[model samples]
Target: MEHPILFISLILEKLGLPIPHGLIGETFLEKMCQPYMTYTWFVMIFLVVVGKLTLSNIEMIPGKGQNFWEMLIGGMYDFFEENMGRELAEKLFPMIATFGLYIAVANLIGLIPGFMSPTASINTTVALTIIVWVTHHIIGIRAHGLGYIKHFLGPIPVLIPLMLFIEIISNIARLASLSIRLFGNIMAKETLLTILFILAGAYFAPLPIMVLGVLVSLVQAMVFVLLTVVYFGQANEHAH
Candidate 1:
């Protein structure tokens, strides 16, 4: 089972890509059944089983996975508490945590054999960005009501229309920036890794690239999460 770009791209869209394109031309049953019967499925299943077993045995002792999870949760908690305040952070924790976990896990999944990261696709990143954009505005309206619109109007009457126009365009630009940044970084990393493997006989040359890829993956996830926080801050700011 070769995981070609087309196949990977198709699976990503099925999971939830923002762009409109038919990646997989297969019926529902075929897609569902094929996963369970494929080699990738076996690897996934094996990892799940091993992960569970490892956790079970570590009931009295902390291991790498538990430590990593703790660190992630603690870091996010601190970040939100500082920026959003404890009450608001608590209120928004579920949404923030879900996005962070989903994206972080998706990025990490790419490190595994045969599985591609959905975040590597522009469609997926764009969809996520749009959702964030909508969520920020909705939260803003709910919090500040009509005043949410005032945030775009600026302080001077003469600049109201101009400010509004600027705000709207800037918000739209976020969608393109977020999507392109993620897609370009992931695609470049994958392409570089392939070239390295080909040129340096598969093992030694890919080592450094793989290490860099992991760092880049983590950074991308962090960037996405931080940008969401910034958007939330802007949307919820009180217009004076």
Candidate 2:
């Protein structure tokens, strides 16, 4: 099959709904694949919808669903508060939390037999990287004003141009680094599982790898969030 997770389309088709036209037609890997409607794209949207419903359906008084949602949000609030400080973290909490949960769910779900991690796709990852990158810069500018540009310059006047040039490249490089890191890790994990399934055809042997994948998934998501936090912190910092 052209698509890595062909069964996703198959199952959706058998549900009596029309098969997604794009899936029925061409492979995502094919030339001129539209970015808007890939399997991973749908999966990402499905997750966001579920999360929105979960939050929307929550009650004021505690119950199973409310408690679960509260704990998740509460814990994340504390986590970011500790990392980025109460003020900055609270300010950026929504963006950080959303990014973290989406990525974490996307990675973990890919462990299932028929799901593919959207982060495994360069397009998905690059888009995320761009979002994070733009967010920090916008926050930085709003927080610190034009003085933010001074951070790119070195302490010494003579080195200002060189430092500014290097800093520009370094900041831009973050987009590539963020995209490649997430994509490489997820793609490697999926590729390894595929190879093991083909070679041994045993259910048990891949269990260890799957367990490791879970840890790696969480770590990758955490790393992505933490780096964003770091950027946010740096962005708001006053130039010395």
Candidate 3:
């Protein structure tokens, strides 16, 4: 089946409108196709659509169509400034802000009629967590040289083996925690909303759930951003 929302989003994006790509339909032709399509093609498609939309409106000022983008950019900048200091924030802003915007937009997109939040998927969350985990270590090493590994070895030489093991486990847990937290919350919200729609099918019945979904989306976005900042901070600290 053709996704009308996706079609409309594509058209609007072409015309330089502010419509979000998440309004599009998300269905696989069969259950067997769901795993492959959802995990791989969906991310690729999302990147392409959002990339085109972003590039097309690059020259536009803050208008009705562009207000959301402007708000997101402004908010992330302000947040970075508050947490990371102006200099560091400016240096790291591009990477952090890009993650925040992409994730926030992706989460909010779920509230739209047809689209599913990719963040709700375990595959997406796990992949993102892995990337973040690797990024944290890479930055730490770059900043501190070989001494970055020393952080895990502890301040004392005798504790090196034990400390290293603990650090490694903790890092692995970070990935699991981040992925599970995001996936569980989003999936739960989606499931609850779906059940509500099934049970009541009344307009007002789903309103409250939808509102909650919006809040959850924002919270999830903030959590991801905050964790990113924390990870960066840890890396920078070791570097120093």
Candidate with best TM-score: 2
Per-model TM-score, in order, reads 0.74, 0.81, 0.71
Q: How far is 226's C-alpha from truth in model 3 (Å)?
A: 1.0
Candidate 2 weakest lDDT stretch, 10 residues: 28-37
TM-score of model 3 relative to the true fold?
A: 0.71
List per-prediction Cα lDDT, in the order shown. 0.69, 0.77, 0.70
RMSD of every prediction = 6.1, 4.0, 7.6
What's the distance in Å from true for residue 21, model 2?
13
lDDT of 1 by residue, 1-38 (tens): 12333354356557764322343336654443342123
Q: Estimate the overall C-alpha local distance difference test score of candidate 1.
A: 0.69
Q: After the best TM-score superposition of candidate 2, give how far the Cα of residue 95 lies from its true spot, in angstroms.
A: 1.9
- Local accuracy of candidate 3 as per-residue lDDT tens digits, 160-224: 78888998899788888988998898878766766766678566687888898899988987899
* Model 2 lDDT, residue 180, Cα: 96
lDDT of 3 at 238: 51
lDDT of 2 by residue, 100-151 (tens): 8888988887788766777777777888889999988998899878888887
